[model samples]
Structures are given as structure tokens and as C-alpha cells.
Target: MASEDLKEDQEVSFCLNLFTLRCGHSFCRVCINQVLNTKEGSGVYSCPECRAEFKEWPSLQRNVTLCNAMENFISNNPQQEEITGISCTYCVHSPIPAIISCLLCESSLHNNHLRVHSEEAKHVLTDPSSSIENRKCSIHKELLMYYCTEDAACLCMSCTLAEEHWGHQVEILDEAIERKKEKLSDVLRKLYMQRQKTEERVQRLEECRGRAHQKANREAERLNALFTDIRNQLDDLEKRMHCEISRQEEQESLSISDLIQKLELKKDELSRNIRSIEDLCNMPDPLTILQEPDMGDLCDPEEGEGEEVTGYVDDPEQEEADEDSKGDTGGDYGFQQILHTLSNIISDVNVVFYGQRPADILLDVNTAANNILISDDLKTATRTDKKQNRPETAESFQCFQVMSKERFTSGRHYWDVEIAESGICWVGVCYPSIDRRGWQSYIGSTNKSWSLFIGRGYRNQCSVSHNKSELMLPYQIFSAGVRIYVDYEAGQLSFYELCDPIRHLYTFTTTFTEPLHAAFCVWNKYVKV
Candidate 1:
């Protein structure tokens, strides 16, 4: 009866793969499968645990709740009792569960035994280690109280007075421990501060990375916007070119058609005359031939008739001849115009998007002509009727011209000239070694100079490579400034008429053999830069 009660209290093992039947009985899946197989021939099934009757077979469902409970119970009751019993090694009356073990005696003790051993032996006790024996000096058999620095050993007070360790530098153990602890604390503090500095550096770098990412995104957006404009301009230009070509084709086709119609009419008239002449020639009598009404009016064409046919015959060739006109003529004319327009647009875009631009260009009085009067700040120059008293130098221009103190040998540069109080001022770039004393030394008059002139409300550009090109300014106001861009390496000098939307005046292409100086000609009053 006692074994039965114990067995009833013990936990019964249950397979995790359990299934529930309609009769409320739980069993492993294997047992349920065997029962279903055994009752298959009879066409009937029942729960093995309950022995309940069922006519039709019903599908079983897994007992998920019971399976989860079993898993948790098994995990909570994991088997871990390796040493089932611990008995006192010192007690002889009966084996007792140990509470503490003594390494000096190499024995386990119960609470009662441990109390008696501690009262009689008075041995130092710990949970497991024999630290008491280790603390006692091997030779002195006493607790260590001082440390000998000279011998690098721990010693009792008696050992310090021994002959072998006499006169050694000694320190109390407690004092040494305190000093070491303070040093260790200082080291830990320094390490903590270093860690903080490293953390701060990392945070700073992360912030810098974030800002850099933002700036890169902004720059990418700007580039995208710029490319969008470029694409639109290209599309518009393409459409215009196509339209112009189509217009020319239509006009040529119409003219050719009209000439073909006229020629067909003339050919029909000639064929009729030939037929009438053939009929007269078919006459048997010579008198009939002579009497056939005025054959001159029939066979012979009227005067000036050849000229009309010749004109009609030339119309087809006229279209081809028109296509082969002078430089940049016909279809090529539109192409050249578009190329120049796109180049101008791209140049303006570069000026707006690119690097450092020309700023305040201070004019050099020493390089100015004698007839030129420079302002106090050396940014304004005025032409005088009489020459002013000034020191003569080879750098000074003898003509009505003044140059900037800044000289450019390479790289691109841009500067604006505010043409005020003068309708006819010349703004351009020229070689520093250009003839400055002769009548032909005027800007745009020599090979070493290129200039843009605005006078009488007219804008004109002059270069040594091509003849003067007359351009219409967006605005008629001459007081508005003009921007000059010089690309030294590319050997290009471009002039722009500055207005709300800047317009390109002209561009000069030439190889620069020497450094160029920014030259200004104040023909009448004054010009500010």
C-alpha cells in the first residue's frame, strides 16, 4: 500500500506527440494509429484509453495545450543530481549530510561536527580553499604584517628583524595596499577620460559624415537641374532645325513643280506644231507646201521664246545652286547659328556654376595713357582733352587706353566693364607688348588685339580672325555693363552684352603667344570697372 501511494504521487511520463479523441481521452499518436488500424476491417473505431464506441471514424486533433504543458514541465524538472548524498567524513556515529569541508583536515563536516572542530582546533575556516594555511609564513609560522621592498617579499614582523633581511626597506602591508589602490583608481580615471575623448571624436566624425552626405545630395540636385535645362535647350534647338529644313524642302518642291508644269505645256505646243508641219510636208505638190499658211509662225518659235524656256529649265538647278551658297550658307547656315547659340548658353552656364570669378579690377595709373585721368580708387578712368603731367614709363600706353594692373597668362577670367558717361568705349583684351604709341595702336585695329565696341546705340565685335560682326544688343542702353570672358589656354575671348538675360555679342578664337592685359579705351568721358 505504501509503494502504491508513492507510485501514485510520482509523475507519469507522457509522450509529447499526444492526440485527443472525441470521447475526451488523451493518448500518444502511435497508440491512436494502432487502434485505428486494428478496427479498420470492422469499419469502426474507438478510443483505446476510454474504450468508447464509435460507428464512423473521426479524425483526431493534436492536444496542443497538453503538449505545451509537458514541454514546460520537462524543462523545469531537468535531471541534475549527480552526487545524490554527501556524508560527513569526520563523524563516526553515522553518515550525515555535510554542511562544510575543511581542507586542513581533508574532511567534510556536518553542522555539529564543524562547531566542535572550530572550538577545539581554532583553525581558520573557509568554504573550500585552504587560505589559512597559505597565509601563515612557511618559516615563521605567523601572519604577514610587512613587505620588504629590497627583497621583494612579504614577511612577518619577526622576519623583518632576521639577519638575512636586516636593514631592508620595509612597508606595512596595509599601507602598501592602500597606496596601490589609489594609483589604480587614478589609472582607471585616466582610462575613463580617454574613452570619453575617443567617444567624442567618433561622434564628431559621424556628424561630419552626415553633413557631407547632405552636401553631396544638394550638389547632385543642382547638377540634375542644370542638366535638365541643357536637355530642354537641345530639344528646342533640334525642333527648330527640323522645322527650318522642312520649310526649305517644301519651298523647293513647290518651285520645281511649277517649272515642270510650264515645261509640259510648252512641250504640248511644240508637238502640235510638229504634227501640222508633217501634214504640210505630206502634201504631194510643191505649191501646196509654199502656200501652207505662214509656216514661220507655226514651225519657227516666236522671238524671246528661247529666253523663257531657258529660264524655266534653270529653275531646277537654281535650288541646288542656292544650297551651295557662300560660307555657312543654306542648311549649314542654320547649323552654324545653332552651334554659336549653344556655345553661348554653355559659356553662360559655366560662368554661373564654376570657380572664382573676376572681381574688382583696379586700374593702374602708371600704365594709363597720359590723356587718361584715373580716379582715387583706381577703378574709374576718364579721357582728358589735354595730357596730364605724369612720369613716363614703357608700361604706360601713349594712346587713349588704360590697362588693369592684373595680368592673366593662363586659366579663365571674367570681368565686367560699366560703360558710363561714354557711348563709344572700347573693352577688350590685348597683349601687353602691343604698339601703344602709334595711330594704328587702337584696340581691334591690330593683330594683337580683339575688342567689342558699343557706339551710337550699335553693338559690334571685331577680331583678327574674322571681319567685324554687327550684333543687336538685348537692350539699347549703353550704360549697362558688358562682361568679357577670356580663356587663356583655349585662346578664346568672348564678349557678352549684360542685361537681365545676358546675350552673347561675339567670340574670338586665336592662339595667345603672350600674356594678355585687360585693356579699356575711354574715348570721350569716363568708364568704370
Candidate 2:
């Protein structure tokens, strides 16, 4: 029983030495010394367990009963605390009534107040010089006394007197602090609004990116489809080109085969003709052997002469026939007959010559309508017939005649006459003036003698003849004449003679409707006559 009591006492004694020096609580000397030395120059020696710091070491008066009790209690209950009251360092009269104490002033205070005392009272509040030095004026070196509302800062008394802050209302520090707080609140509200706008812009950009991706995907798909179509078209084109080439090759091959076949057939026919000619040359010539007589056999017929001694003198006709037979022998009858037959065939074939043919003319005897009027300038040698109802202006004229058999039989015919004055002549062939090839001429001849001959055909060749007679007269008579020719067949025109066969001459005539000078404005311009 005594040993058990002694062990209990030993346990309590071990715990009592574990308090810290900073908090006036017993602890291991080594543990307290490590904490005190870590913060040696800070004037704060803190307890490791309770974080209680002291400026100086407390009196080491050991409380025997309490320390033993605490030691036993801590050993049994490891988390127990000692509820000790502390005194305030700043107000010595007030009891701190807390577990911690201020290390700097060596006065007891609350655990929380111990930290505040060093920062606010011991270091900053106790040093009046540092406090005044830290409160520097923001604008000037003078000590700040007032705050400017407009400048949003503390200003020295001298700065407040400046002209820049003349109209601005000055305030104390308390009031400036309140205003700055309100302004900060406003700035925070604006920042929130700007944040919302930025968020909206980001959302729009995200949507735009999504749309761009979709469009790019669609374009890629379309391009792929187009490429596929192009490939298909190219394939089809290749097939068509290949087919065309094959067809051309087949046609060319067929043409070559046909040409080869024709050549082979021609070669076979030539070979057969050559063999037949060789066979004909090999045959013997009977005429050649018959012409040669056996004269030796006739002289050696001694035995045969006795048997038939009726030999008489050869006839001159027989000798002459023998001589003639010798001369006619070896003649080539087949070759001569072949040559003669070939020559006859060639001679019998007709040969044609190519050139022009003679000309022939045809004339149509037709009358004009009664309504048309003839011109007045026309010359009339004799008025065989007259119409009472004809217009006096003579705008048109028509005449018709049937030729006799003698006139038709004439090979070539022409008319020669001289015009007394300038006039227009309307020539016609086959039909009336409507059918003639028309011509206009300015007459320059007085008593001009002209000759018109039958051309290659029956067509009349009209020209402006200005040749005048050399005979001089008192009155100048513009005599221009034209000749008319008749052709039974239509023919081409020639200068003076017939052209060739196949050409025919045709009959033609001319009539004057009006005076040439009046109808063609000949009076405006004069020609040498």
C-alpha cells in the first residue's frame, strides 16, 4: 500500500515540471527554453500549449498542492486547463480576469488583448513620435490637418489654403473616411455591372464560334460532294473516249482486210492468164512441117520407080505452085489475124469532138394593150394604120408583125438607117418592148450612117454610136441611126460574124416612144454633133 502511494506521488511530481515559463505554468525546462529562445528579441516568450507570451519571467514560487493536483489531473485528463484570472496591463486598476498576460508591460490581460497591446498600445500608441511621423500628408510635407472631398485625400493645412482646393469643402478625417467608403461602394457596384457586360460579350463570342464551326462543316461536305461528282464525270468521259477509239480501230481493221482480199483475187487471176499463155506457146506449128518437102526420099525411090514407070514431065503450073508455096511458108496467120481484128475494132469506135455550135434565133409576134400610150418623139416613115383614140402625149407605143417564109429562111439579116436627131430607141426581141434588153444613149451624130449585123444569136447588140458624116450642110441635122436584125432562132450576140454552132440568132426591133432629147433631159447638156 505504501509503494502504490509512493508511485502516485512520483507521477504528480513529473507533471508539475511540464509548465511553461512564459505563462507562470510549470513545464519541462528544455521545452520552455526552446520557445523563449526562438522569439528571444521579440519581447514575447510564449507557452507552447496555450500560446501565452510574457515580457519577463514571473516569480518562480511553486504552489505545492495546486501543482500536484494539476499534474495528477493532467496525467489523468490530458486536455484539462487551469482557470486563472489575469490583470489588465493598460489599466492597472482593472483585473484582466483572463488566462493570458501582456509580456511587454508585465501586467495580466486577456489572451486576445495580449496581442493587441503590443501592436496598438506598446509599439504604436506608446511612441508618440512614430505616430506623428507615420501620419504624413499625401500632397505636402506638412502634417495633415484636414481632408479634401474633391481631391479624395488628406491634406495639410498649407495644402488646404491652395487655390486648387479653394471652392472644395474640407472635412475631418472621420468624415473623409465615410465618404471614401461610400465611393468604394459605388465603384464596386459599377465593377459588378461591367462584369455582367463582359460575360454577355463572351457568351456572344462563343455562339459565333459555334456558328462558324457549323458553316465550315457544311462547306467541307459540299466540297466533298462536288469532288465526287467531278470524279464520276471524268470516269464517264474516259469511257466514251475509249469507246470512240475502239470503234475507229475496228473500222480501220475492216478496211485493211477488204483491201487485202481484193489484192489476193487480182493476183490469182493474173497467175491463171500467165499459165494459159505458156500452154499456147508450147503447141507445135503444123504449117511449118507441111511446107518443108522430103526431097531425099523422092530421089531414093528406085524400087518404087520400076513399079510405076509412068513418069511424065512436071507441069510448069506445078513448079510455079511449088515456088509460090515456098514463099508463102512460115507465114504467121494467127498473129496477123489478131492484129487485123484489133485494128478493125479500134477503127470502128466513134470519136467525138467538143466545141461551140451555130446560133439560131426565135421571134414572138405579139401586140400590146390598147390602154397604153406611146410617146410622140418617135419617127414614123409611113403611117400605115392610125388610131383615133390614142393619147396625144404618146406615152407608149406597140406594134406587131408576122414574117413571111422568105424572111425566116434568110441566114443573116440587118437593117441600116440614120437618125435625123437625138432620140431614145426601145428595142425588143421575141416579145415587144417589154422583152428587149433596154439601153440608154446620148446621140452625137448628124447624118450618121450605122450598120447592124446578125450577132452570134438573134440578140441585138446596141451601142452609142457618135460617128458623124464629114459632109457639111447649112442646117446641122443630128443623124443617129440604128440597124435591126432578124433571127429565126435565139442566139448569142457577136461583133460582126457568127460565133459557133449551138448558138442561134433571134429577131429583134426597136421603137421610140418620145423624143430622146425631151425624154432623157438632153436639152440640159449639149453633145458635139
Candidate 3:
């Protein structure tokens, strides 16, 4: 009997049985079939769990025994039974089948029930004699006479007339139920639209999150690369710093050793010189042991006979000789020579004298020949006089010739002159004529024996003397000689050798102050003697 009951239970459980694989897994029949059909194989099936290969395997088949066993377990446990009660569909009271249908109200009930019931039980299945109606009214206990649409039921005449339902457009229960169902459908449609909007918002947020995650990953990679590069640079810098420091230390050590060697050599030389001087002072004179020499007689008593006398040589003679020898070698070595050499070296680096600059002169349009005027300041001379001199010729004078009626070119030119004898002299510029005749010249004092001349060519020439006595000429007749002078404010004088025939002569009156009286003559006919 137990075996039979088990078989029956198995059949019931199998109605909902599912298939499972040999891997100790289970699924529905449809799910297993899908996996098996899609798997690639011909002769053998591989165990999904152990991945073990097998040959000559049978096709996939359901396990009937297992299915039956599971179905049997299900069938043995049956559902529980439910208890039911009978009552009127519209009323609160229990109903009985003893009474027949009512003729006045169309209701059923058992006999011996109340002749009239409450309004709530008016629609129950009861006999007509027991149906609820007057006794007064079911609700208010008064007689029912009117029907009210607002109240949705039959009411007493007084209730209909009352304010509660006087003017309302209310309906019966059936109409109210229909109206509520329509409103519920509209609310459901609106709720479905709101749900769709919420789903769209969720999808957009997911996309944004994906993009943010990708950006963060890329930034992390970039930072990692930068860190690696910085580490490499720091390593290289450390290596270079070590090399530089080692090199500098080696150079400093070498320089210090060389300086120490030079100082030691100088100290040794000084020590040797001191020792030599001390030894010389301690030596004794060899002349101290010498004997006295004899001397012959001074006057002869007779032509043939003579007497001799001698005195000891003085000891001071040896000392005086020693002192004289020491004077040549003692004291500082090459002191004067060292001073001279140092002075020469310093002089080579110093600037002592500078050469003169040639004057720059231009033509003066106003000055006339022979009566030419000198510069007022005497620093500059102009051939022509104007109210305010032009800058090009303001600092120097311009030369002109009355015969040529022309001016000299703007440039430097040189000339020389000499005194016939030792005397005061003056040199100046001479404007030339068209026929090369001298028209004008300027003269000034040779304040000293020598002076300087500076200016542009024939335009202007300035002569300054260095000695007051040299300005007076000793001879009236003199010969031409070369006198070279710098034509600017530079202080220098040069004399030229003169070989022409001229002689000494005396002067009557000499004036170094004025140009007219300061002239030195050149002999025209014969050499003065």
C-alpha cells in the first residue's frame, strides 16, 4: 500500500518537473534543451562540471525517474479545505431555505421571521410577509411614500422633503459605480506616463557616470607619466652636481700647493744672505802679523855714505783697506738697478706728451689785404671781420690776397721761418695776390725764445713765444731760416737747420708786444756780416 501511494504522489509532482544537467545543476526543460542544442558535438558529450570527455555517448534524454520522484513529493502534500457560510447577499442576517419566495417584495426567507425588517435588509431573499416596509419607515420609523434620486433609495415622504436631498443631482448606486470606474481608468493612464519619464532619467544618469569614470582614468595615467619624467631629471641633476664639485676641489688643491712652493724658495734665499753677512764680520785681518820694514838715511853725510831709518806700519791701514772693499759689495743688492727697472716698466704704461692738432680755418669775406685785423681774443684770427662770425670760421681767421681777390681752401698748411741772428722774431700769415704777391701778414710777440703757430693754411696763423728776451732781434739784417711750429694751442717747438749765407747784425729798437714792431727781416740783396 505504501509503494502504491508513493507512485501516485510521484505522478502528481512530475506534472511541474524541471530538467537538470549532470553538473548538479537544474533548470526548466526548455532552458536545458536550448543549451544542449547550441553546444557543438557529434559522438560524445562533455561533462560541464569536470570537463571530462567521453566517447560513444547517447543523445540528451529526460530523466523520467527523477521527474517522477519530484512529482510524487509534491502530490503527497495536498492543499487544505476551506469552510463556507450562507447569508443574504444584501443583508446582515443568515438566511434559511424553509420559506418560499415573496410575492410583494420578491424575496425568500424562513417562516416565523419578523413581519417587517430594517431598510438595510429590505432587499434580502426573504418572504414577502417578512419584507421591510412601513411600521413607520425603515430608516426613520415613519411610513415610506417617496423615492429620492440624491439619496439613492426609497425614503419617507418627510425625508424627501428635507434639505438633505432637496436639490442635489445625485444618482442611484448603480449609476455611481459606473462613474467611479471611468475616473479610475483615467488615473491609471497618467501614472503610466510618469513611470516612462522616470525610466528615461535613469538611463541618462548612467551615461553621464560612464563618461566621468573614463575621464578620471585618463587623468590618472597622465599624472603617472609626468611623475616618471621628473624622477629621471632629478637623477641626472644629482650626477652632474657630484662631477662639478670634484673638479673644483682638485683645481683648488693644485693652486694652493704651487703658492706654498714659491713662498718657501723666497724664504730660503733671505736666510742664506743673512748668514753670509754674519760670517764675514767674525773674520780676523791677516795683515796683523806682518813685521816692520827698514828706511834709508835722509841726507848723506858724504857723497858716498848714507844712513837709513824706518817706522812700523800703522794697524789702521789694514782696517781702512778692509772697509773700502766692503763698500763695493755690502748693503742692498742691485738696489738702484731694481728701482730703475721698475721705473721703466711704470713709465711704459704712462702717457707723457701729446701731439698738436692742425687748425681748421675758412675764408672770411670781409677782411682786406695788408691791413688785415687779428683775432680780438687772439685765440682765433679771421681774414675778414663780421659782426657775428660764422661757426666754421669763428674760432680762426681766413686769409685773403688783395691782388688775387681770392680766399684759400679750408684745410691745414705748414710754413717755416728763421732769425738771421739770435734775436726776437715774429711769424704770421701772408695773403697772396693773383700774381702770387704778398699782401698781408700777422705778427705777435714771442713772449719767450720759442713759441707755437697754429691755424688753417693762408686763412690764419698764430704765433706764441715762450721767452721774452728772444723777442728782441740783435741784428737788423737777417737771413731766411726754417722755423717749424705746431699751429694750435698745443705746447711744442721745433727748429729747422739753416745753411744759407747770412751773418750777425744788431737791431736798433725791438718790441715784442705789437705785431708791426715784432717782424723779423729776410735779407734781400747780400748776406749780412
Candidate 4:
């Protein structure tokens, strides 16, 4: 064991010859013998403890267990004890204990020979102290018994009575030490309390920072998914536009190729006519020309063919009409559609991302009402007309309601609930201890819950309810979803319209004594969080 752990046991039993009496008290043999020697002639004796009477002198027995334990402890811890112990400075043969220390000589001696030292007061002896120089004043070389508070210095009797500090405030050295020690203790306690507060604040800041980073990561993931979908849609639009433009290009090229073929045919016919005229003029070939039986048919092409071919002319308006008839959407139509799509996407994003994060929630199937159906992913919940085959349990809701599986006990969190059909559902939070089988157990039916009832009994109306009390909103909610926010330690639960710019609907303020779970009640359709 370490030195400190063995100090108390060593102090109680340090001698080798230990003995125990009938009363079970153990002490050194030397001490026991001394006590017994004084009571030798007495007819009766008593134990130091328990005071048990003994008719005769009790025999002492060596305590083997205590003797061995002491020996083992001392052997292990001898270095520490010897370092702190005082020894005689004059004993050169063997180590010996010192009885007194002379301040003038600054040495401890056994004093076995008194004639060796002076008898003057300056050489006076006191308890054997290893640091005896501190007892004397530096200038007067006299024992310091007072303190000069004006100079905050230790002083001897002569310094306080005759030195330049004669008029300064002074007090006994022992009293000054005691007063300073008390002040130091008070300062130490305040410092400890301040340290604890700083540590606690540091822990709180660390937690807040961790949660912020987590929220940022989740938001980044959601944005990536959204952008990925938008990119896919744009790619499809580009492909369709390319196909339509290629079709229009092929149709116009075919019309131009047909016109070129007609011109080539007309050129060949004209060349043949020129050759026939030249032969008639050069060969004096009037007879030969007249003899050509089919010359008339060759000289004149089909009567209306030339007129029909030459009448063809490009018209921008006609081409546009043809394009419309053929259902070509290559120009402006796709561009406008893309602009509309982007506008809608931007508007929806403005509503969803309102400088706040969405909490993840899942419906607890075990807590659903009899007719409620949970989607395979445990995100969507709908109330069915037919009852389900579910066993009765304490956690199950009796009405068309279900609670989320996750429980929130501290910090701030918010989640969005998308309503398939407005004015047909209720969304809110409730204590986990809320009732299970009665009307009182239904969400917002008791004081343990707070809920926003949507589109229940009126058109363009919603209400916040608690403890059977309700406050109906005068304004309409065109929002497709609702945002539920809760600050647990702050005791604030608020609801907002999940529309563009996010409007506040209501808030519930009260001390929440239990962890809360997201609760929902739906009469038709479904809600997804």
C-alpha cells in the first residue's frame, strides 16, 4: 500500500512486541507492562476499554496477526517515515532520536552531555525542529514572536519595540497565520464553485454545437436528393425536345430534295428540245424533222406539270401551320414549361426550408388505433373503414390516432406532417403517460396533451385544443402540411402553417413534467411525417 494509506495503522501499532488482553484491546508490550505494574497490588483490574472487571492480573498474549501486519507495513513504508523523522546530529555511530534543538547553532542534539553548549538565552533549546531558522528574525537574530502587518513581515520582540516598524500595526505570529489560512480557505471554495460552473457551461456549448452539425448534415442530404430529382426531370425534357427538333428537320429536307429532282427533269427536257431545233437547221433536215413522228409529244412536256412545279414557294406562316398540325412543340413551348417548373420548385422550396430543420419521425404500429394502417416504411398512417385484427394493449390508442415511436425529453426539435386532405385530421404532441382506452386518452382530450385540429367541422377553419378548450382560427390555411415545434426545457410547443414563408398557427406554454411523443388523429386519408 502507499505511505498515506498505511499511516493511520502504523501510528496505532508501531512497536514490535504487541500484546492483547482478554478485553480484545491491543497495545505495545512496554505500555501494557507499565499500566499493569502500577496496579500490581490491586485485588481487581479493569480493561482500558469496556472497563471489564478482572478478579486477578490478566495474562498478556502476543498478537501474531497484528505483529506481522505492523512489521509488513513498516518494511514497505520505512523510507517515507524516516525522511520526516528528526534525529540527533551528534550521534555518529547509529541513528538516534533528538530531544531538543538550539536556535543559535541551528542543530538538533540528544543533550546527553549538557556541558558542551552555552547556558545563555540565545542558545536556548526548544522542541526538535528541522527548520529552526524560520523561528529567528533575520536582522536581530532573535526568535520571531510578532508580525508587522504594515510591511507584511515577520518580526522579533526587538524589531517591534525598537526597529523602524515601532508604530506599525502588529499581531501575534500564530494569530496572523490562522487569519490568512481562513481567508485562503474561503477563496479556494469560491474558485471550486466557479470551476464547476465553467465546466458545466462548456459541456452545454459542446452539445449545442454537435446538434447544429447534425442538423446541417441532414439538410444537406435532403437538398442533394431534391436536386438529383430536378436534374433527372430536366434531362428527360431535353431528350424529348431533341427528338421533336430532329423530326421537323427531316421533313423540311425531304421537301427541298423533291423540288431539286423536279428541276433536273425540266432541264433535261429543255436540252432535248434545243438539240432537235439545231439538227433541223443544220441538216437542211426539214424532211427529217417532219419525218420524226413523236417530235410533238417530245417537244411539249405535260401541260400543267411545269406550272405546278414552279408554283411551289416557301412560306413561313404555312410552315408554322403545318408544324402545329403535326404537333411539334420544339419552339417556346418546352422553354416556357421549364420556366414554370422552376418557379414552382423555387416556391415549394421557400415554404419547406424556412431556416429550420425537419425532425425524423416514424409511426409506432403498436400504438395505432384499431382501423389505422401504417405504411410499410412506417412513415404514413391512414384510417381505414374496416377494423384491423390487432390485440388490445395498454399503449394502443382507442380512437383514430397514433403516436410516433421516438420520444423527446430535452432540447428543441420540429417535424413536418403532410396532409393528404385538409380539415380531416389532428396533429400535436402528448405526454407518454396519457390514457389509452377512454375518451380522456384521446389526443387533445385532456390537459396532458396539446393538439391542432384541422378541417374537422367547418370549411377553411382550424383550431388549437387543450383540456377540452378550443380556439378557432379566423384565417384560412392553404398550406398542404403543418410544422410542429417543441422546446422541451423552455416548455413551449408551437404549430405553424407549412405554407410559403411558414405562418404561425398557435402555441402552448406550460411546464411539461414528462417526455413527449408526436401524436396524430386522422378520420380519412393519411398524413406522412
Q: Count of backbone clashes for each model?
A: 0, 58, 39, 2
Q: What does the lDDT read for residue 63 in candidate 2?
A: 41
Error of 1 at 190 (Å): 17
Candidate 3 residue-wise lDDT, 1-529, digit = tens: 8766765654532333344455555445544445444443454455554655544221333455666566555556432111122223234365543333332344444444334533453433432333444323556665444555555565555666678877865444345556667887688668656754554454355446545644555555544544454455446555655665566556656665665576577568657756654554455753432331221232234632221111111257864775566466541233344444433333221211113232333323233232233343322222333334333222222332211112223322223343323333233332221112222222222232233332222222333444232233222222344333221222222322222211111111222221111122211111111
Q: List residue ranges in candidate 2 displaced over 4 A.
A: 1-111, 114-145, 150-153, 156-168, 278-529
Look at candidate 4 and tell me the lDDT of residue 77.
Answer: 62
Ranked by TM-score, the better of candidates 3 and 4 is 4
Give the deviation of candidate 3 from the true structure as CA RMSD: 42.5
lDDT of 4 at 207: 50
lDDT of each: 0.70, 0.39, 0.38, 0.75
lDDT of 2 by residue, 57-161 (tens): 332323445555654554574321232322344555654444344323434545566566656433212211213444556456555657887787678778888
Candidate 2 vs 4: which has more lDDT = 4
Roughly what TM-score does model 2 have, to 2 decimal places?
A: 0.28
- True-structure lDDT of candidate 2: 0.39
Q: How many clashes show up in model 3?
A: 39
Positional deviation of residue 241's Cα in model 1 after best superposition, in angstroms: 3.7
Better of 1 and 3 by TM-score: 1
Q: Model 4 TM-score?
A: 0.38
**Candidate 1, superposed: residue stretches over 4 Å from native:** 1-236, 239-243, 284-286, 293-333, 346-362, 370-389, 398-400, 409-411, 415-425, 437-442, 453-482, 497-503, 522-529
Which has the greatest lDDT?
4
Ranking by TM-score: 1, 4, 2, 3
| Ten-residue stretch with the least lDDT total in model 4 | 304-313
